[model samples]
Target: MSDKINWEYIKEFNDSIRTIWMPFGLPEIIDPSHSRFSNGVDIQPAWKIPPKIAISTTITGAMFSSRGNPNHPMTLEEISKSAREACEAGSPIVHIHVRDENGYNVLDPEKFHKVIDPLKRDFPDTVFDGCMCALDSAEWPHMESFLKEGLLEVTPINTVAVLYGDTLFAKPPYSMIEKTKICQDCGVKPQIAIYTDADVDNADRFLIKPGLLQKPYHWIILAAVPGCSPMQNPRQMVEGLMRTYNNIMDIDDTASVMVCAAGRASSYLATFAMLMGLHIRVGMEDTVWKWPHKDDKIVNNAEHFKLFKTMAGMLGREVMTPDEYRRMIGLPVRKK
Candidate 1:
């Protein structure tokens, strides 16, 4: 049998267990056991280059209870303070989510400016990445403004339409294509968020093939969230990364892959991703639990980054600097 991965089989496996995401379209249930590539020939870790980790300091989350962490930042000053701490603790890239005075998640560019301006000034080398969340066609201009104003240098493009409770948006094939154009026009790099392997295929066929999305292809793979693609364990994380690597290898082998997850699973999955020479994302946005269990206290963003840094060092994996990370993702150097 050929050692090459069968992309068609992997896509079929993703569809086999696909379930409806309530009010939104179907998102696959990722059980690696079901993937044809799961039990195949072992793929070695990519160690020629060092590892990197991004911090997603999600000030608030879907549950609305500070993700069970009372210390989670809910105001601009608190968020700003957390960002500074995270940067000092060794996080090169920060994925941010801003909140208004009322503690509600808002995509207002002015509010974003309040958070980003001081951050860019304080930590000039830190890479700032964020999401516009669910936006309608009318809100497209606001997104464009965010990019033009230098509020967000890296933006996330969720590969599929998502709906969680009241949060809903359609990221259909056409919308993804349009978003790619927007990223290209604004001179911002798109970090494609993959919930399943099919998302990777769509990105390759619709964006890469058309010359809309460029290299080095950056991706954030979400693992194991209820009502979405599940990849909360080592096996699942390996499966997800393997599928992504196989798909992107066809387009560009130098792509960057970072993994994050919900709740306690976030830490576990991220650790495994590190062992494989893949990057990781940490912070309250992904999980508040300090350990890979629910009994732990809800740690802040800095605490999260410190833990990941310690673990990476223990494993002898050198964490990349902000400039190193910027180079890996093809980001231009910012003036200090």
Candidate 2:
């Protein structure tokens, strides 16, 4: 009830804020032994292998509405055709999302087989990975059936909850452990989909330390998704990616990190990741737009793959073949 303002308290608060804003000088040369900063130009690790970029294509994602491309693949036959084209275009890894007759994403093993069986027959060298509804109760059963049938070489286990539009994709710690155990038992690999920095810490603590996840870990750093921690801003997207990448490398330096985005920034981020010696995931599943600023819609999965390949060529990086990718990721070659 005093008329006078709290000048002393305000001064104290301003001083604390100034202290928080004080910048510290950084050394001219960062230590090469630093966990996150170990990968530098001069002190490149002798064990580092030659650069061979691996491309993973997501033919169809659950969120795409097929807006401009009415001919977008929805049925099993159409999906198979799209995936085949992608493999033919030099993308060895295909990330799949199977849909029902009504075009709804479902965890049905039979539907997945209908799409995967034909591709497996035709492209034995191609590696297949897929997305699943983490909240579905039948996730495990469907995954088990898929593994038994050899329908997938990799399966995704989201490390944290995220909002995809209005829907919340939740990943309980117990569910993640169970999924990892199933993958380990089946000799299949788990692609950790990281939506935030916390996802990395949780993966290291709940999955890695517990021995549920094994070495040569494969991670997909998801960026620019609608309601995730990373936003659509370019600065935010890159910062989030670098932070997550460093954190993952801290836990497992040999791990394979792949970059993927859910918006127009997909192409830019994928290129940045490729140049940084990381893998990339592209196609309609990640974005409908061909570029960040343009409204151009991606014609097909093959088109996107070809564009990426051209960019890789310009960067002087060779896109790995299916067999080469398999060897790099520690998967046995399907073709003799």
Q: What is the C-alpha lDDT of each candidate?
A: 0.70, 0.78
Off by over 4 Å in 1: 1-64, 162-169, 232-234
Task: Give a tens-digit lDDT track for model 2, residues 1-336.
Answer: 675988778777764555444223245344444434434545535444346888889988887755635646777778888988987876888988877788867777778878888888888788888875544665767767777666788888888877865888778998888888877688777889887788899898899998778778888887776766655667876787788899999998888888884576778888888778888888887667777877777888888888988988888788888878777767777648
State candidate 2's TM-score: 0.82
Off by over 4 Å in 2: 1-50, 68-71
The Cα error of candidate 1 at residue 138, in Å, is: 4.1
Candidate 2 lDDT at 186 equals: 81
lDDT of 1 by residue, 23-46 (tens): 322243443233434565344543
Candidate 2 RMSD computed on C-alpha atoms after optimal superposition onto the true structure: 10.4
